[model samples]
Target: MNTRIGTIFAQEFRLARRNLWVGLATGILGLFAVVLGVFGAGQGAALDADALTLTAASLATLSVYLIPLIALLMSYDSFAGEIERGALALTLASPVRRWEIFVGKFAAQSLAVGVAILLAFGAAGAFLALSFGTGSEGIAAWMRLMATAFVLGSVFVGFGLMLSAMAGRTATAAASAVGLWLVLVVIYDLALLGSVMAASDGIFASQVFPWLVVANPADAFRLFNLALIETAPVAGIDGLASTLPFPPTVALAVLGLWLSAVLALGIRRTKRIVP
Candidate 1:
């Protein structure tokens, strides 16, 4: 909010506008939105509750992968790349506080990705409205889906920024970001599946499964969006929805905690950057 942070934030957006990766990420999200919209409209199903449910499910499933990956890519270089190229040092030498730099960069990257999500999903919504007479419920559901995707993307941007701050070089930061993505997005689920199978009908599985799913931001995102639907696109987790400790609101709070915790850590770590 201060002049220094505002300047840094504006500078980040200006630089991001020219970044090829930002353009590519935005284009990919837009492409997915258009494709999904066209495919759903082509189904020619009446715009009823079931139709809205189906569309929500489809978008949630797609977003679980797309939003987080794009956010991670956009933020992986936030500090590492700047540090590698000496821009961070130059900026620190000025009157700016390190926290200002970190917060400014984080806010800028989040806004960029958030805007992309809005435009992409907005386009889809427009198409859907044109194809099927707009209804209040349908529009509300789409809006919820869009909001959830943006929050989910912000969580991963925090993750990427944390890695960028901790890693000493861009390559290391990028590698760490990709590895975290694999663990959270892919390997974690596989491991969870194995754990569930091994602990089948045991007290540990019954007591621990819900917490495990909630602990992972990706699973939380999926659960929060798919909570209303009877079936979930993610395998092996649908059955526990009824018994989960918290509701979608809690999952969203957990994601908020993720964004705050990681970004705070990143800011703290970034202050220690030498030269």
Candidate 2:
């Protein structure tokens, strides 16, 4: 890109590297992926499927719970922490546009997390490919898993940045990040299920439940990847995937929309940061 943004991106990436906790958390996730890939059959013979498919399934389950949380942890303090310490004032004094700083930091945080995911999935993929054969279909599925998983994570990176921009305090931003994760990944789905059960045969279950699942990036990510493998079912979630209101590609599109919308809000807030 242009020299200005490029410089900002490089600087931001360097700054992002200074945080080792992000690397450690994601490394632990990658370790889990490898463990799940290599030994998933121990869980049950029924689950003894293609290593890649099993890897994807196990990871889909794990990531919906972990990726968003980790993404939020990586980004929760991007602005608020700096601002809390009066560092943002010095940053604002610099010649760079506020939007550029926010965009650059966002890109850098995303890249840092993305690379960890790439490595995590890559290790599992290598094992799955070697054990299951390097057929195009299997390879394609693995690639799709990585892409979808990363998109799912990026949605929360945006979430974290938005919280940081709006909260203006590191503690508030951190707490909001965790709260948002619980709402989207856990409480939202549980509440939706409860509503469907409570309103069984009502228009809410018939007309709204399916759309509501797609509305949460977490659920959309879960269904899309489960559908991708056509798993031969994680606690019956494959059935949910089968019943997706929209195509799997549309879930990916929804994820893209979430990331874009949240990042836009973060950038707008950045421009208004007093210091």
Candidate 3:
């Protein structure tokens, strides 16, 4: 099983690398890292240790959202594109089980995006080490940031694969993935914010907002990084501790749920394809 899955995953990764968006995202992430490092170095004198730690943590948190967007783009056409090109049927004619094909392909897609993020964070870590002269802690923090980014990315890529398996064409899959991403990562938060605003005087606003934030995978990733390694809680969420039970743990669990749900759906949907 391992050998079969590894073969398919290797092939899928090569195919994914040919996609223009994958390369473009990698380049953009590298550029962003360099630019962020330069900005941090330039502001070296103005900010102290605590402020620097906070800023780095905040930037790492932001990557939770940015990385997932790219991951979705990477896998949004995994199955649909092949079907559109009339190649999916031939590929399925092989001896591999559909579930293996689906899981292996999604794994490869997730790894490809993970590689991009790893490169970006590595560059950022080197920069911090050079500028701050405290490479130990900065490098450690970035390493955790990379792991968190990779896990968050897996959730998005799995969802994209599921969308691709369900859609009739690559275009439809792409549209649906983008729409879902926007809703989950942005609109959902905005809606929660609106609800909180409307109930400003109520207990729900003060008590339930943290739980609502956990529903957004991006926020969950941020909370995980901020609360755990950074030990710097999110700003302006003082009521969170009293309401949300184990915010970091819950966030991790929610992300795990998304990954499992999407991957399971993708595998089931792909198995049903006639090809």
Candidate 4:
């Protein structure tokens, strides 16, 4: 909230707004929200507690993929693209410290994506609540989803900026961003499954599997959100989540670690940038 940081935030937020990525993301989330609400309601069954839990499960799954992708795209070019266009050099010539620059830009990007998510989810949740009488618990669950989803976006914004700081070109940063998304959001769980299954000793699956899931931010995000739901979307994952050796709090802590480590590294790399 420093003056200089605020200025940078306003400037970057305008850029994101002008680019229409925010609008696009909001539209996508809103579309899915409507689909989920309408189809579930059309079945002639009022969405009681159990039905609402399934809906929560679905939203949690959607957040796992979409939020990270939105955040990464917003941030992957933060430094590298600016540097590529020589704006970073001019910004570097200013009196602001590297940390301030990263914080300002990341804050703006997070705010943009966070607003879009809340708007879409809020509208959808309200519609479902009014239409189906989801009651207090369902409202609270949606609120929780909004909170965790906000943090999840911050986690990936840090990731994208970290990669942005390290890459010399926007192309490299973009590629790295997408690959990181794929690895963490998609491939990590699959690889972990393979490792657990192949472990002849069975100790890995029993003792180490949960920890491994914690190490991946995407999995950690999913675990934290799903731990509260009775019927998780995936059969195998829900079984693990049921007796999830550690509570949802552990996954939340690991996500915090991810954000801190990446932000620190981003600042470190920013200090090294000649621009």
Best by TM-score: 4
> Candidates' TM-scores?
0.91, 0.91, 0.87, 0.93
Question: What does candidate 4 score in Cα RMSD to the true structure?
Answer: 2.0
Model 2 local distance difference test score? 0.78
Report, for every candidate in turn, its global Cα lDDT versus the true structure: 0.79, 0.78, 0.74, 0.82
The C-alpha RMSD in Å for every predicted model, in order, reads 2.4, 2.1, 2.9, 2.0
Best by lDDT: 4
Ranking by TM-score: 4, 2, 1, 3
Cα lDDT for residue 151, model 4? 86
Over 1-275, each residue of candidate 2 has an lDDT whose tens digit, in order, gives: 65656777787677767767556766887788878776864543475456677677778878889888888988899889989999888878878787787787777778877877888788768866776544565567678778887888777887898889889999899889989988998899888777777884767754677778888899888877877776536663336677666678877878888988987888998888886
Candidate 3's C-alpha runs over 4 A off are 20-22, 41-47, 50-55, 135-137, 229-247
Please give the distance, in angstroms, between residue 86's alpha carbon in candidate 1 and its true position after superposition: 1.6
- In TM-score terms, candidate 4 sits at 0.93
The candidate, 2 or 4, that scores higher on lDDT is 4
lDDT tens digits by residue: candidate 1, 3-74: 998998998887777786567766787787667766765453543343444566678777878888898988
TM-score of 2: 0.91
Q: Please provide, for model 4 over 1-275, each residue's C-alpha lDDT reduced to its tens digit, 9 standing for 90 to 100.
A: 78999999999899989999789888888778767766655442543344355566678777889999999999999999999999999988889988999899889998988888888888887777776666565666678788888888988998999899999699999999999999998898788888877889967777888888877887777788788865444566545777677878998899889888888988888888886
The weakest ten consecutive residues by lDDT in model 4 span: 42-51
- Lowest lDDT sum, 10 consecutive residues, model 2, at 231-240
